[model samples]
Target: MSPRRHRGMLLLVLCWVLLAACTAQPTTEIAGSRPVDTSARAMLGDLRTLDPCTLADTAALQRFGAVSNAGIVSLDYCLLHLKPDDRTLIQLAVGELTGPDSDRPGDPVVPQGALNIVQNAPVPGHCTRRVRFGDGVSLQVSADLLAGEPGAGLCGIADAGAEAVAGAVQQGRAGHRDFPPNSLALVDPCAVLDTAAVNQVPGLEEARPRPSVGGHQCSWGEQSADAPRVQLQHTAGEPPRILHGAAVEEPVDGRRTVLSVVGGDPQVPLCSAETGHIPFGTVAGQVEVAQLVVAVPGETGTDACAYARGLARLAWPNLPPANP
Candidate 1:
């Protein structure tokens, strides 16, 4: 054989041999391994100036009016929200890590193995803080501890890591605006998994984060078309810290019109609305969904509700009620 062809064959054989060894070995070494630090508090300060939407301290959550919002503070929670349907696989992986029989020999399922790494490997503490916004958005941030590793836990890590990287990039592009909507600005979870070399799990297709837009698209979408409206409202006794928004689906002539009205003082945009859309073929083969995002900015106090209501009214005319 020609020298170049011989080298190619040798390389291919080496890959096959490595694959065989991985397949033959059992995944028992990772279970109940020494616990790694995965705390969110440790990383909070570093990320504070990174994104205005994130609070450096839990106590500061109140200042941002997150008391009644759905709080998210763990890498696990963040992964769940970012990819809700993959909860079972992720939880199973965590269970394996925490379980007594983790080292016991079994089939080398990819998802379970990936979860084991996340549960056992250490991560910065500050990435675990839960932030809630009462309305529709809640965030729990964490670093992807196992980006280049192979195995079950690798899948989740790749997905979450890509998301974190994507989020950071998108936020940077948006200049850290307040109340950003959930745009598919993160890397494709599936592509991340595929590149990470953890594609052996059954039903792996279901665990992937499909893109809403087409090839080579940026991770995040553009800013909302309408300017955010701000409002502050008072309750009976509590030191008010509540933010609210509505994401309602309105169907129009065989099409869906999604109207999102967000209300808060100093409203922090979580994800961009103009850029957020469900991926094609994610839900029963649907390709795209229309969305409208409106921000209501300012700090919390009296008149917040009134301002929100007015904005909703304005949006109502744009959407109109769906026919029965």
Candidate 2:
């Protein structure tokens, strides 16, 4: 999401300055073509209800003072919290390990009943553990224990969390198996926006995968890890659920700005400019409704919002028209 071409130009500022102020659409249920097979194929659907906040059972990681520090969940990614914040603590990311990348083997280890487990240190001081359950379920944990509450045994704790996630998914999304239905669950995020349009962003001609777990994160920026010129996802609750009745903020350009304070969470930076608002009827109004999200890391200045808004506007003409 971003401002129109005429938002008086973008002002470049530091990343932290984006804490200024904002608001944050809706409805759709695209049914899948695959039949429900509970034996081994149902795990992904069951994951929709997995709350990242409670994914790691307290009893499992007893030795540590691990407590929820505000976790965010979506259709594909979850970022669990670790207490005693000091920039160093527990970090967990659980997401689908599909595509050709999952087949590539790495350092070996074995978790109970897991199809494959690979533990690797991508960078110094950081350890990442990945587990693949035979049912196409892959979970990962990355730990860089700096100066935090439970500094030691970060890897072990992450593994425990991974194990817990597997068990939880097997137990079936906490009995919320039949959720309200996420319209964008099976959508291919790349298809949401046109490549030609995405190239319009100054430094985004090259796109990279978001280095985090949760949601399908792809950024159009330099290969510099989290630095994204434009980022996109179709995950659950990342942009927060849009509620009716409240008037959504629409600026003079007809573009919706995704402010930093969205849902009162300064961490989420996004903006959206949509065409022809259509009330969600049975929710599945269009492909972009709840299924597609465009964002900026809020690194520069207000262009993060403008970029998001502009991208949304550029991609709109290509999107399916609103359901009448």
Q: List ranges where model 2 is wrong by over 4 Å.
A: 1-55, 82-91, 95-106, 122-125, 134-137, 144-151, 168-187, 203-222, 225-229, 236-255, 259-306, 316-324
Query: How much is the lDDT of residue 48 in candidate 1?
Result: 15
Candidate 1 per-residue lDDT over residues 1-324, each given as its tens digit: 112212222221111110011112122234668532222212222221123223222232222122222221111111121222232122101100011211224423223221221222324311221121111112223322212222324334433433343244323321221211222222222231121111121222133222211111111111222323221110011111112343333333333333332332224331112111232212242222122222323422222333323333333233212231
Cα lDDT tens digits for candidate 2, 236-291 = 33222233222144532342323322222334443433233333222343222332
TM-score list, all predictions? 0.20, 0.54
Candidate 1 deviant stretches above 4 angstroms:
1-247, 251-254, 262-279, 282-286, 299-324
> On a 0 to 100 scale, what is the lDDT of residue 215 in model 1?
15
Model 1 per-residue lDDT at 224: 29
Q: lDDT of all predictions, in order shown?
A: 0.23, 0.42
Shift in Å, residue 288, candidate 1 = 2.4
